[model samples]
Target: MKGFSAFLGKEVKEQLRNYKFLILGIVFAIVGLLSPLSSKFLPVLLESLVDDNITILLEDPTYIDSWIQFFSNTNQISIIVLLLLFSPILSKEYEKGSLVHMVTKGLSRQSIVLAKGTLLFFCWTVAYWMSGLITWGYTHYYFSDSTAEGLFLPLFSLYSFGLLLLAVLLLGAVLFNSAFVPLLTVGGFVIVSFLADIVPVIHEWNPLQLATRNTEILVLQEGDRLLAQAMGVSYFICIGLVILSIVIFRRKNIA
Candidate 1:
């Protein structure tokens, strides 16, 4: 526990020094602010773009629309930024020979992986929640009837999916020594997951649904069962990936 705490502290300090936290915070806050602002003004903006003679039939923006924008922005843009930021988790250390020194100094490989994963997860949670809170506040102010059923379940499911992605990236880092390799690994996984979604039988259990179907859950209270299943699968997959990373890192020959 002591070793894990020490390494976790080191990871946090490193992230702070690199300005990762600052970048993520700014990006997510902007996303939060934009979600509601765009939903509210998009109709007017579109109308302005058109000539006065043209009639643009658009529905009034609601809190649901704001939430849709929020999830879409977070699922696509925020997640990409997060993946890019942390893609080099283990590879950078390998390149710099930092892990070699730590291993030689009596740090266990499992502790290293666990600490880094925990720190990254913590940062992701904080950034995500900050954005969520901002979005909620703006959404309420804009639309007084902004209540959505089963909101927390969908949000948490999306968060779990993020953790699953991070774990997979970590495993990829352990398997390959290049910074780009882990990113490619994650990309390939996403592609395969998308392809898998084409099959009807797989929809209920697909982890990707956690990212894609959040709006449905928020709007209709639909997919509650699917959300639960996807969350379960995602968390288990995250744990499995972390364990696999530890096993592989232990056997890896560090030069």
Candidate 2:
């Protein structure tokens, strides 16, 4: 924990100067706004595009529809951008030998790992909830019947899932010096998890459901135990990865 706070402050300031926060804020804000708006209007846009001779009947959009878009956009657009933006988090430091300089100047390896991990988690939490809250408010305004009684668990599951991804990302960044390799590491993780889900007994433990099954949970309110179990597993894995990264990083050669 030595110099953890100072390094975290440095990380925050660097992100600010680099416009990472601004870019993420804008991207998530747009993702938030688009959720409800697209749910409400995309049907009309599609219908209007059809020729007069074509008759298309689309179901009236609901708050559920809005959430569908929310999860979809967050998974497809927001998460992708977030990963790309931060994939080089540790790898770039490795490339520049900046961390070596800091290490030589009395910054502990533990502090660096903990500080960067904290930064990643903090950024993900803020941006993710910002998008969630925005969609929640707008969806309610547009559809008063949008009573998301079970929204919290689903949303929390998604948030927890992001933490899992970040943990993997941090480990990836530590193990690989190239930015793209970390991205591929995340991809490989998802692929393996996805494949593992094909086994019925393993599905309950799959963290991928946290990202993919939010809407189903919101609507039916089922799978509470499943999500809880998955969250527990994810937390355990996340902690392990961070620890592993710290160990690997401490022994890594930066010269």
Candidate 3:
């Protein structure tokens, strides 16, 4: 137990030392500030492009617009940032023989895997929630009278989706020795999800619903079933992937 804590502390320190925290903070903060700002201002920006003779019919934007921006920006940029930031988690250490040094010093394999996973998961949660909460605060502030329902549902769904991705990436990191392997693994999942969506029968069951239907959830109540299904499937897969990581890491040859 003590060894776990000590290794966890080392992982946190190494993450901070590598500036992952700074990158996470900056990226999420940008998304937070910009999501609402873009939602409110984009119409005006688009309107300004019109000539005097042309009139564009613009429906008054609602709170749903803000959330649309939030989920869109998150699903697109946030996932990419997370993949890039964590891509090196295992590969970097393997490249530099960092784990080999610690393992030689009597560090347990389980402790090392747990510590890295803990720190990575914490960073993902903090960055994601900070962006989300900030966007929520600004959305309400900027559009006080506008209402978008099911705000919490999409937020939780997005956060959980991130956790699922993190779990998959961890498994890829443990199973393969290259940083690019996790990126490819995540990309493959994304492609598969896209394909799943095209089949009408599987579309509603897709975990991609968490990120894709966020705005719809705000406007309509019907998507809640899809959200729940996504949450369940994603959580199940995430846990399975984490367990797989642990099992694979235990058997890995670090030499």
Ranking by lDDT: 2, 1, 3
Better of 1 and 2 by lDDT: 2
Candidate 3 lDDT, tens digit per residue, 1-255?
Answer: 777899888778887898888988999999998998998888899899889799998887767788888888988898789889888788978888888888888888888778778877898888988998888888888897655455777678778888888888888889889989988998898899898899987886778887777667767644556678888888998888888788889899977
Best by lDDT: 2
Native-vs-model 3 lDDT? 0.83
Q: What does each candidate score in C-alpha RMSD?
A: 1.3, 1.2, 1.8
For residue 64, what is the lDDT in candidate 2?
A: 93
Candidate 1 C-alpha lDDT tens digits along 69-138 = 9899998898889889988888878888988899888889889989978877887899898898898889
Off by over 4 Å in 1: none
Comparison by lDDT, 1 against 3, better one: 1
The TM-scores of all predictions, comma-separated, are 0.96, 0.96, 0.93
- Measured on C-alpha atoms, candidate 2 has an lDDT of 0.90
Count of clashes, each model = 0, 0, 0
Error of 1 at 38 (Å): 0.5
lDDT of 2 by residue, 45-95 (tens): 998899989999888999999998998999899888899899989877887
Residue 80 in candidate 1, Cα distance off native in Å: 0.4
Model 3 segments more than 4 A misplaced? 147-149, 221-223
